[model samples]
Target: MDNMFVLGIMVVGAFLIQSALGFFQIKHFGNEYNELKAEGRVAIGKRAGKLTSGTIIMFLLDDEGVIVRGKKLQGTTILARFKPYDKFKGKYIGAITAEDSEMIAEIKITRNTVMNAVNNYKMFINGEAIPEKGSPFAELVKKIKNI
Candidate 1:
C-alpha cells in the first residue's frame, strides 16, 4: 500500500538523520578532547621539573616541596611516574601509580566538606569570614553580575 511505503521511507530517513547527528556529535567530542589535551600539555610544560598528579577529582602540583591544587580532582594519589603517550609526545600527563587507598577517604571527606561550605556560602576569602565580602568567589560573582 502507498501508506506503508511512505511510512517505511520516513522511518529510513529518520534513521539516517539520527545516524548523521550521532556521528557529528562524536566528532565534536573528539575535537574537544584533543583541545583539552593540548592545553593540559602546555600547562604541564610550564610546570615541568615539578611533580604532578591528576585524578578524577583534582590535580596536585608539587613544586619545591610545596603542594597546591592545580585543577579540581576527584581521587587523590601520589604520582609514581609519568608515561608518554604517542599522541602526546614529551607530555608526561598520564600517571603510572596505583590509586592511593589511604588518601581516598580523606579526599572524599575534604571534597564533601568543601562542597558543603560552598553550597552554604560559608567559605572565607580574605581576613574576615563574612557571608558576602569575605569570599573571593562571591566577589567574582558580583563582578560577573555587574558585567
Candidate 2:
C-alpha cells in the first residue's frame, strides 16, 4: 500500500512539473511575440516544438514584402523566406533576400526527404549558396524553384 501511494505521488509530481514548464514557456514566448508585434514586425510563418526545443521563432517579414522567385502572392510581393535554426541557436542562414533585388516568389519544398522537411526546406531557402548540383537537397531545391 505504501509503494502504491509513493508511485501515485511521483506521477502527480511529474505532471505538475511538466505543467509548470509548459506555462513558463508559453508566457515567455507570448511576451516575445507581443514585443515583436509592437516593433512592427509581421510574422510570415513559424515552426516550433520537439526538434526546435519548443522555440517559437517567428519568420518576421518586411512590411513592403519584396519579390524573390518572380511570383506574386495574391497582391503582395513574394518576399524572401526565413527560418530559425533552433532555440537561441542563431540561424542557419542570415539573409534570405538582398536589400533591393527584383526576384520573384521563393519556394520552400519540404516533403519526405532528408531528416525533418521543415528544417531542410528552410536551410535551402535561407542557405548562403544553393546546394551542390546533383545532391538530393539540390534536386529538391531545383524542383521548387522551377515550380
Candidate 3:
C-alpha cells in the first residue's frame, strides 16, 4: 500500500513538472513572435523615400530585380531612360556592345544602401554601366575622355 501511494505521488509530480515546462515553452515562443513582429514593423517604417541612382559597376545576383548604380540622377525616370552618355551632360563615356565583353560606367547609389544591389554586377567601362539583360555583348570599354 505504501509503494502504491509513492507511485501515485511520483506520477502527479511528473505531470506537474511537464505542465510547467509546457507553459514556459509557450511563453518563450510568444516573446519571440512579438520580437519578430516588432523588427518587421521597424524595417517597414525605416524605408522612406527613393534613394540615388548611378551606373551599375557590378552585378550581384539576388532575389530582387537587377540593381543599377551610377551618378544619382535627379529624376525618377533615370533608370528607365538611361542612355549612353545622353543623360550625364551629353558625355558619351562608352557604349555596351552585343558581343560578350567588358564595360565601364560611373556607378552611383544611395549614401547608405548596399552597393552590390545598386550596381547589379554589370561591369562599368569608361565610366559607363551596362546591363546584360538589355544589351547583347556582356562587355565594353569606357572612353578615356568620358571617364
* Residue 6, candidate 3: C-alpha displacement in angstroms: 0.3
Report, for every candidate in turn, its global Cα lDDT versus the true structure: 0.36, 0.37, 0.32
Ranking by lDDT: 2, 1, 3
- Off-target runs (Cα >4 Å) in candidate 3 are 41-147
TM-score of 3: 0.28
TM-score-based ranking: 2, 1, 3
Q: Count of backbone clashes for each model? A: 8, 6, 35
Model 3: per-residue Cα lDDT over 1-27, one tens digit each: 999999999999989987887577447
How far is each candidate from the true structure, as Cα RMSD in Å? Answer: 17.9, 15.1, 22.1
The sequence of per-residue lDDT tens digits that candidate 1 reaches over residues 38-127 is: 443212111111133322212232322122323322222332223222221222223211233322434444334323322232222224
Top model number, TM-score: 2
Using lDDT as the measure, the top candidate is: 2
Candidate 2: tens digits of C-alpha lDDT, residues 21-140 = 767755755665565466554332232222222212343333433211110111111122223322212222232332212112222211111122224345555664333337556778
**CA error at residue 2 for candidate 3, angstroms:** 0.7
